[model samples]
Target: MIKTNYHTHTTRCKHAVGSDEAYVLAAIEAGLDEIGFSDHAPWPKHPLEEHFIRMHMDEYNDYVQSVLRLKRQYANKIKIRLGLEAEYFEDRMEVLKKFIDETPLDYVVFGNHFHQLEINGRYYGRYQKTNQLLEHYEHDSIAGLKTGYYKIFAHPDLFVRSINQWDEDVANMSRRIIQCAKEMGVVLEYNLGGIRNFSHVDLAYPYDPFWDLVAEIGADVVIGVDAHDPEDFLDFDSIARAEKILEQKGINVLERLAF
Candidate 1:
């Protein structure tokens, strides 16, 4: 049901399992008109910065070059976007600026996957253990998500994953996030991947709050397969489920997303 997709990983991520061309070709077969490559940005990982599922620098650069080449070669048929899944650590803004300078990028999406999550902390996309852990991380990511520069917040309801916080405080926190994003004009991600239950835990709606908030504020919504493999290009079926949920919430426009 989606003509475009903006989130996917190539073989460059190493943990991901697909060739750059294979991903694009699969999108074409799936009838996607646009595709965006948002590999994890290269970060200086430390013990303090867990959840860092990244790849080697050379592999990342090669992946970008390869995809850009493919994009140019295949431009007549489909649209291709080059971007990064940059972590949001506001304190690292300078570092991020350097990263942006280092890599040729078209757009950047923010994902808060870290332990400290404070303005000065880093994100790695790992899960936490308890309610306290969730609260702490959520606070940190909330700070990161406030940046007005990000084109889209990758998974608006990320707390459901790493921390699974669904208390009054968490709910209040989620609402504030919605408010901030709306004020800033940042697009909220439907995170079609929420349907997969990949957290190995039971969450009724992994990305519910973000979508719910999108509905409440009439904010723009984008879909992401968060695909790491070729087969995932067909993730529309899962996204359709999320789309239906969002429809029930009053946000009707499911804008096509290409990285």
Candidate 2:
């Protein structure tokens, strides 16, 4: 059974909803042992570029404080952690490293969402299907995990959302990425948010072929609620669906994170 989720979000990200406390309460109600609030991380100098998807730099302190407060308040009820769902922006990684070094974050999940930078980078989910896109996605995914900063890789097969058909390129990319994560010991998430938001035919991630490759590679995985709302934590149907599918695939699903 999956008892912990580290891919949760917050209102600070602009795209997620629910009070920070509500998420904790819901998780507790749902019998979760631990939960990590990984709201979209903010860049140091780029304040307003992606405010629609992430929090502003000014709101960073409050976001951290909120999670810390919740962590303390509900210490006995549930294990709450402070974290960020960050994209590995190669150029400003130093800034991220400096910030992580300075903050009290418990973990950071690498969300390989964009090509290079969200400021002008292509959104992988909405890209035109091409080998170059797959190559960039593959390259960035591997490089980000090597950074040693991210504990989990969120939606590793997210690049497939743009493609209509699976081919050798997709299969090879999936195999290499899965093998890389296994070697790095980074946890790959089977994202429930994708299941909740998009139909089976619509969302490419939690992609069947990709997950099949994970099983074949013997890579370990964790099921992430990827909760955008408190109600999302209560969506037992989607959670069960993910659990059933993962079980059927004979995947190695971790009930809790190692670190």
Candidate 3:
């Protein structure tokens, strides 16, 4: 049985559709020790912005309340952690500090998916997604790691997400980020979503190529299925595949899943 899942989502996040209680019950059957409810933060609505959203702040608070209540109700059953899978928006370190300071958070997982990528003459977040370099991720992600606000830097190898390249610049930047996060005691996460969501031929975020530098640097690390729904909780096959990949790199860790 897996220990925990630190990357789970609930139906309240809008994009995901499953009851929070259902996920918790599944974790019990899966023999998970902990589960982090890290729903995404809400994106403001606009006529142009129709597809992106997370959970309302009020609803998020209610979620925390419910989880807390369940933790007491379950007591010896499971350990539920309150967290947010937040975006590393450009120029939002203070917002990070404020959010954590005000909220009762066990941890925060940072991802830089907000880059502006042009699509059909418009932008999809803005690298044209054409494999060009992005300053948002290169700079913002590094900054977030430096802020010392997270327990784990969710996906350390997001560099190849846009370019699918693993050359000099890629290696250099990755080394810097891993080194910085390692110094801060923030473990870098080697995610298995690439195995589950993106095929071996696809350009996956936290690309497998990145494990080379991560292992080379001897950075503290963890493996997560990046599980979203109940069906994915404590999925040992994905976890085993992730471990095998890391083992090929000669990097090993006893990580428990927690979302």
Query: What's model 1's overall lDDT?
Result: 0.68
Expressed as tens digits, the lDDT of each residue in 112-163 for candidate 1 is: 6555342223332345345465565556556666654467777767656544
**Cα RMSD of predicted structure 3:** 3.4
Q: How many pairs collide in each candidate, listed in order? A: 12, 0, 16
lDDT of 2 by residue, 1-259 (tens): 5688998999988888888889999999888989999999887655535546888888999999999999999999999989999998888898679768999998899898877667544788877545578878888998998898988999888887877688897899889988998899899999998897775565477788889999999999999999999988889999999999999999999999866
- Give the per-residue lDDT of model 3 (tens digit) for 1-259: 3476777777776667667788888788888877777777554333444434466645766877877777787768888887777766544456557768987888887655554221222221224545445444667667777777777777666556566456787778778888888788777777766567665655565576677888898887776656566777656687777777778888756556343
* Model 2 alpha-carbon drift over 4 Å, by segment: 45-48, 119-121, 128-131, 200-203
Q: Is candidate 2 or candidate 3 better by TM-score?
A: 2
* Candidate-wise lDDT, in order: 0.68, 0.86, 0.67
Model 1 misplacement above 4 A: 47-52, 116-135, 162-165, 199-201, 252-254, 257-259
TM-score of 2: 0.95
Q: Is candidate 2 or candidate 3 better by lDDT?
A: 2
Cα displacement (Å) at residue 254, model 2: 0.3
Name the lDDT value of residue 199 in candidate 2. 56
Runs in model 3 deviating more than 4 A are 43-51, 116-126, 129-134, 254-259
